[model samples]
Target: MPLALYMLGLAVFAQGTSEFMLSGLVPDIAADLQVSLPVAGTLTSVFALGMVVGAPLTAVVGLRWCRRRALLSFLAAFVLAHVVGAITTSFGVLLATRAVGALANAGFLAVGLATAAGMVEANAKGRATSVLLGGVTLACVAGVPAGALLGQLLGWRSAFWAVALVSVPAFHAILRWVPATTSAATGRGAGPSGAGASGASGASGARAGDFRARRELRALRRPRLLVLLALGALVNGATFCTFTYLAPLVTGPAGLAEAWVPVVLALFGIGSFAGVTIAGRLSDARPMRLLVPGGLALLVGWLLFPAVVDHAIAVFALVLVQGALSFAVGSTLIARVLYEAVEAPSLGGAFATAAFNVGAAVGPSLGGAAIGAGLGHRAPLSVSALLVAAAFGTAGLALAVRRVRARRGEPAGRTLTS
Candidate 1:
């Protein structure tokens, strides 16, 4: 792995903390801004929505710039948004800032993922994807909890300030370590030397822009990658739906005190960290071996969650296991997306980023709608189960497509499950 990979991970950690921390501060924000709880909750929704919108919007615009320029531009905007968020007193201002920040975050993750994969050998792409995603899991474990703590001790705005402060170093790291441009090394055959193909060993940034933007847009029509994108949305929907509702489930159904909420969430984070670590080691070598069991286990966990939520110890244990399986399968799915997106270059990251954010926006909305309609905490778990099942079906479709391609002896260049 390149030093820039770690830098990307660190940058992800900085930005991801803000993505998850607002849930803890919604009440404070509402109270301070003189808004209802529901309005305040829209902060999170707005962020998710921005991420969905930002992926392709930025991808289209960023397709023209070099990898380092795009990354630095996104990171700068992200940090600026946080700084403004921390200072803003008006609800409208803060809302706009969240949208802006989410856009930057999405852009960074989208491009960062491609950059990370391009920096590694084909065989190591899975591990590289895991390494890049590790920052997100780590944020769930450490940065988010810490942000909440900061919010509790200082003010909600302090969390935003912290995110801005921590992210400064990542900007420097990107500028210093990542290559400003790609020549022969950035395109599909980033080959032995990885990033530059000629032993340049750049970060995971891909010159997906090497292809025309129209070609990148056409990549979206590919059925195999489309199925993978849908699958990504489904699996992510399941995980995030469960995640968004875990706190209420802990306090209401699990019979745990409020104080234990963060601890349980952290346990889930610990499980996620473990999952990413294990997946990083094995995903490159045997992705299906991990994905099959991990996905199945995640499905079972969701199905069992409603029944066992009343059991404190059992559910707590389940959170850890489910978290592990959720990320193992999710990360592997992303790695597979990268594999299939090899031809898309610039569009590859946007496709995966957009799909993941779509899930992020939809999953919790479905679960919340269930809750709003008077369904209980178990409602979200039910939603998660259905989503997981749907993901399984999508995965089967991907497999079938692969087989059909194999039988027809079509080019099948880097088809799914390849």
Candidate 2:
């Protein structure tokens, strides 16, 4: 609800656009760089790898700085990387720049979530996180499509330049509005105004340094917490496997025009926005219940994808459901991880984010391999269905673990159903 949250959303929008736009521009990038499409496609794979490597990597290093400072620093790095990507002519140089940008993107997100959670009252945590993540959904809806359009009109490099220009204002907004709260200081029983808690809120005035880092890492070692991370990874992997190649699928076998690809993707984005908004509120109230339905929706959507691809109307309708279901799981899973690692929510949340990135990295590689093996568009979708089923299984496993713990007279830690 704060003005700063809106600014943070803008920063996320720029980052998300830069991250997802590459998928749409893969052909252009390939042509411009004088490389094959599959080789050019590695741009995305490298970015995902950066995210997987960067999330926890930055989280560990960022423990020594104020959250606000770290966020600003990462955004600045993101801006620089985009600029480097826009100007570089060599394929290797562009790839390195993208990887660096990916690292910044990962750190920005991990810190951003932790920062947003710190910004609001405990009861409003889900809403705060949702608002932050909305930028990512918006990117899918608006940013990627627009970038693709720019690539079509100008060049792939031009699209990166445009993103770089957007990042300028985003960076300024972050520096001006984001508060300088450290992780430990932010967790002192609520905000400074007594808006959510009573008594001296600053009772536990710990410094943000090595001691805090060790404590946070220790909290993340819980089994229930680790399971949540794996679940997040699996679900994300399932989605991205098909999602990254959607444009190709729709245009190739689905018989859709290249121009319409962005529009359909935007529709999915609209669904994602709706899903995130609805799921954010529900997850905070009941995570386990939300996860069951969310996982089922994902499973059903993937299974039905093969049937719907040939018809425009069917593809549109299916994408809406797919987007909604896929994103709906985010807040619930995040809340579950944080709840389980109550003593050190930041590290647990960061680990879960890392897991998600790991999935992102794996999904595209698997999808690309399937496509490379002489299987067509259907291969990726079918594989996505299987992955979603595995995610469902993981969710079930999490639920069973909770029940077993409850019966054993031990704390179930946290319920995904909340």
Candidate lDDT (C-alpha), each: 0.82, 0.76
Residue-level lDDT of model 2, residues 1-418, one tens digit each, is 7787877888788888988988769998898889999899889878878888888878766665666667878888988888888888899999999899988888878777777777677766677777877888989889988998898898888888887777677666667766554442245234553222112224332233556678888878777777788878777787778878888988997898888877778888998888888877877777667788778878888988898788888888988888887888855677667556667755655776788878777877788899999999778888888877777687678778779889999887654444
Regions more than 4 Å wrong, model 1: 183-185, 188-211, 398-415
- TM for candidate 1 is 0.91
Error of 2 at 7 (Å): 1.2
Residue 126 miss distance in model 2 (angstroms)? 1.5
Predict model 2's lDDT versus the native. 0.76
With a 3 Å backbone cut-off (N, CA, C), the pairs that clash in candidate 1 are 115-204, 115-205, 116-204, 185-196, 185-197, 208-345, 208-346
Point to the candidate with the largest TM-score.
1
Query: TM-score of every model?
Result: 0.91, 0.88
Candidate no. 2 TM-score: 0.88
Off by over 4 Å in 2: 31-36, 184-208, 372-375, 402-411
